[model samples]
Target: MMSTPVANHEAIEKVRDLIQGIDNAMLTTMTSQGLVSRPMKTQEVEFDGDLWFLTKKDTNKYQEMLKHPAVNVAYVGKSYVSIRGEAELLQDPSKVKEFWNAAYEKLLEVPYDDPSLILIKIKAETAEYWETGNKTKMVKTLFERLTGKESEETDLNKTVDLD
Candidate 1:
C-alpha cells in the first residue's frame, strides 16, 4: 500500500531541526551540459518549507535557475536531508536588508545594498531525511551487522511533503 503523505507540523518541524544544524548545503541545478552542484551557505532562519541563499545575478547558477527552476538541496548534519524544490530569483531590496548580515561585507567584499546582490528562494516540495539513532541503537545495529541479522528498528527514514 502507498504510504500517506506526511504534512503534519511535527514532520515539518523535524525537517527544520535537521537543516538548522547544517551550515552548508550542496545545491544541485540543471544545465545544458549536465547537472552542476555548488556549496552554498544557507541563510539562518526558521525553516518553514522554504530556503534562501545569496548570489550574484550575473552568475552561471542564476542563469541556470532561470533556465530550469527545479533544484535539489542536500544537507548533512546529525541527520541527512534532501530537499527537492523550485527556485526563484528575487531582488527585493527590503528582503535583501532583512536577510543581510555584516558577514556579507567580508564574504562579498561589498555592502549589502549592492545592486548585483540577489537572493534565491527555494520553495521545497518534498523533503526526505535519514536520522541516525543514539549510541545504544548504534551498538545494536553494529551487533546485528556482525551477526548478519537485520535490525528491527528501521523506521529512521521519513519523507515529508512541504506543500
Candidate 2:
C-alpha cells in the first residue's frame, strides 16, 4: 500500500516554526497604483493554519487589502518564508481577544475595543521557504579553505513548498 503525501501539513508546521523565531513580516499587497509592502508585527498567537495581524480599518494598508485581498507575507530569519494568501478583515470580539495582548495597547493609537481596530486574517494557500547557512559559518569555512585548512562540508541550501 502507498500513502498520500502530507505536504501541506508538513509545510505548514515548518513555516510555523520559522514564525516562532521571527515575529516581524513584510506584508505585500496591491494598490490601484502599484505594489506596496509594509512591515507588520505578527500576533502573539500561534501560527496554526493562518497568520494574524492587527491594523486599523481606516489605514491605507486596510484599504489596500479591501480592494485587493491577494497578499504575500515574507519572513526571514534562519530561513526565508514567502506565504501567499487572501486577507480578510476580522471584527469579531472573540477573535480579537484571542490575539490581543497588553503590549499592543501601546502600539495602537486606538483602543483594542475600538471598532476601527481590524484584525487581518491571512488564509495561506501556498508558501515557499529557503534555508541558507549562517553568514559567519559560511565566511569561516571559506577562510579555512583559503588558509590550507580542511573544513567540514555542510548542506546549507534547502527549498520547501507548502501548498
Query: CA RMSD for every model?
Result: 3.4, 5.0
Q: Give per-residue CA lDDT, model 1, range 61-111, as digits (tens).
A: 999999999999999878879999999999988888888888877887778
Candidate 2: give the clashing pairs.
none
Each candidate structure's TM-score, on Cα atoms with residue i matched to residue i, is 0.83, 0.78
Error of 2 at 139 (Å): 8.9
Model 2, 1-163: lDDT tens digits are 2223586677777778876768799999999889999899888777766889998877899999988999999998877778888999988877776777777788886566878888899998777766655777767776887898888945434445544
lDDT of 2 at 84: 89
